[model samples]
Target: MSTLDTSALVIGVDFGTDSCRSLIVDTITGEQVASAVEFYPRWKAGMYCDPDRNVFRQHPQDYIDAFTLAVRNALAGVSDEVRANVRAMSIDTTGSTSVAVDRAGTPLALTEPFRDNPNAMFVLWKDHTAVREADEINTLARNWGGVDFTRYVGGVYSAEWFWANMLHVLRVDPAVRASVYSWVEHCDWMPALLTGTTAPDVMKRSRCAAGHKAMWHESFDGLPGEAFLVRLDPLLAGMRERLYRDTYTADTAAGTLTPQWADTLGLTTDVVVGVGAFDAHMGAVGAGIRPYSLVKVMGTSTCDILMAPAAEVDGRIVKGICGQVEGSVISGMTGMEAGQSAFGDVYAWFRQLLAWPLALLGDTPDAQSQRDGILHRILPELERQAALESPVDTGMVAIDWLNGRRTPFADQTLRGALFGLTLGSDAPKIYRALIEATAFGARAIVERFREEGIRIDEVIAVGGVAKKSPLNMQIVANVFGLDIRVAKSDQAVALGAAMFAAVAAGLHDSVESAQRHMGSGFETTYTPDPEATAIYDRLYRQYREYGALIERLSAAEAHPAPHSTELCTPN
Candidate 1:
């Protein structure tokens, strides 16, 4: 094989829930060196709180393991000569995936009440333990018009956001609150660790992570005034020291990799580590997406889109958007992101519970033969089932908040609902409902963006979900009422991180230039159907009424019955 001589060699490590993947990047050419993926063996036991519920988490050590394997594998592909030219190293990780570290920066062996507790361990982004807190934050933020600080966070907050989860811990588990000196996430903290910097050395933060997850703002005194904290939890007033000033984009070097970490990852100590950030943002860049252009990181959960603009929208924008921050995506633009927290998980759960061959199920199923994933042989039984249905004849409409809404209305307390279910309903009815729910969710976000005047000129889709399932895209097109561009790169997040490594190593002058040359292209596009759009418009109105009624009733009742839709419900 002919080899390409690159000016700079850098590594971009992407830490996912299952494992960490390292990509070796040629800064000059914007090419991927031999990349490596490491999976977590312990994932089976700890990762799933319930297959039906979209519950998940990952150990920090698993992250380190992923990084180690990815780096070593990349180096194995490098020639002895190119190895010497290697410069900076960096990592992109899932945000708000946090752990309690001691003064020495070690995560204590998880204690009782929290070991299995999703909140205490590493509350994965999809984790919903703080649903109650999220609801409260939403109420308060909406009450205040976000004047205090939440204005940056789309007028409302969710339990998944940094502040809500942090406050949830302090109120729920006082002991954990006390022992935890530093509440840090691997996305940001891992870079700090690699650089041999702790709170003192590098209390520094990633602008992307802080702006999106931690609510860090360079403009107004970094993450709302302390008054908001005191209002949430009087104890939180002291946490100002832990929060850091938002650093530049992830391409900027946070510091040099420390000797110990370098040795552990089998890399040279000279490697540069950039401030860590969420995988979704990097995926946008990796897919070669531009700001004002939205990129979807669709995997187990569908993180909807990210964009940046020069000026902020007037007044407030949407209800539950994560954030609109300067330099969050690329420098000098407001990076905006929102997500559908349960798409993939919902599909996965359907398959696991119903395992039937598609041919056997046909359009109709007897009551005796109803099962979830076990009944279907397709990768996603939901998609397969939905694809077989007539354009839109299934008498099922669902609220796609099974794992709760991630954008538009970031309420974790919200649950999934299936309306118009009758005895005639089958697995396909429920399956189609799930698809429509996600489509409606997307519409909610798109509408929110337009309302804010973000001017979502174009949309580029990436991720395993976008490639594997065409029906999902069609549903999304019909649902959101917009055509979306699918990313050609299957591994867009890893590619995005590599792009950053190139920039930090001086291979690329800026991200936009890198995106032009190195960015992956796209395939087919799915345009919205106006007929389906009109039908969906009527359905969405019903979905809104049903959701508002449920929310009001749930608020009134001490323990209202569960929502109509059931994921793992037996056939």
Candidate 2:
């Protein structure tokens, strides 16, 4: 590693599903000097969402407000000199969280008439309300006698992506369709917003978000052509023109911060804003990702990122995973993505299920306190008990498709299932099964990569679940029959953004150099237990069998065989 610049500082802001986190880091040592988090006020209040319908929307103002507060608060903990030395900033966000915008790139939700309209707000990445639209896209891409836009994206278009969500909104809302000028991903928009270059054509789009979600590949000559989009839906007729033709890697600087934003954030106008990308991509970099090393961002949902030299991937496509985009992670490497749609979220769902009685306990202060206490303890206690359960003896098996499958094929229509449950089944037993199921889901992704000739030499884990949950980590390691290393930084996602900022600010020659100087080493490693791995190998076979059966059943239910009255009598 080269000598680092101790005087330089960079800020990395991470926008998650519920909150934004800001971290100030020293460019020389990668020490997290100060950090703060602020929840989106409107999202925290559960506004513009319908859980049952799988429709989730976030107002743009919430992002702006939360980011502002988080940065200001994080900066408050540091000295005047440290704050003044801030050279550049970068951001990562959950995607394909996107919103409709006017020509100037202002989100529709910020306008007067669309202030409260969910359709005008950002459609969150987990929102699956656009299933029909996604299906339409898949069907069109496969049969439309044009370029298969989804070929690089696992040959499936997902509801939890950009075009499907945009199409869904355009088809349902006439006012929005007529007035909207373009759409913007949350990751791309923030840097543009800070730089005051919000115009759809002028803003630098993220290669990661565009390639993974919107099917924007260099071979396509930009986004899917107007004819293909129009054939999918008339509402998308002119959208191709409205969007941009080029996308940028995160190492590039979008622009310097505008005076207005600089004043708002208590920073200088010279501060550079690096182009943003999806959280998991940057998080992988932050965790010290290397070629063929899978970095799993284990969070509410998971986004597993892998990188390889261009020569290794070279025109070969891996089916049933997320998109394989060149330079999405490192400038010259192939960044491949795959993930489980629900990881930690599955645990949270069970916790909520177990705490149902708390709803009836009333909203008084004491009752609320009791409810909070119990809720907080539920997961830890479950983890403890689940750890004690015999992994081989637990007959229960679960499908971690509660939020649908995101990898080994992206199918948002699939629902979760539990098998082998009996009268003797208890909460801890069930919880153990759920944890095993998630691990199995992860293993399936790893298997797919290997099956497709992509080598995974090691696994590095980052994010909340990786840092907090040893039980889950051990299960995952056992299921994979491989050792798993957890990254030391708690805010690896933000750290990644800062690394990119360092490059964009000219503090480092390349991402690799910045990482060499700034990267935090692994905190611990989880080695697979031989006995547990042997047992899981058997259970994994059973899990696959059950999953295949469930998928067949689901397909039959969706498209049943027609009845033949005459045939029944003959039989």
The candidate scoring highest on lDDT is: 2
TM-score against truth, every candidate: 0.86, 0.98
Clashes of each: 20, 0
lDDT, each prediction: 0.70, 0.93
Superposed Cα deviation of residue 217, candidate 2 (Å): 1.1
Candidate 2 lDDT over residue span 437-512, tens digit each: 9999999999999999999999999999999999999999999999999999999999999999999989998999
Model 2 TM-score, all chains together: 0.98
Give one digit per residue, the lDDT tens place, for model 1 in 247-273. Answer: 667768777878887777666787777
Pairs of residues clashing in candidate 2: none
Alpha carbon RMSD to native, model 1? 6.5
- Runs with alpha carbons beyond 4 Å of true place in candidate 2: 1-4, 564-571
For residue 245, give model 2's deviation from the true position in Å.
0.6
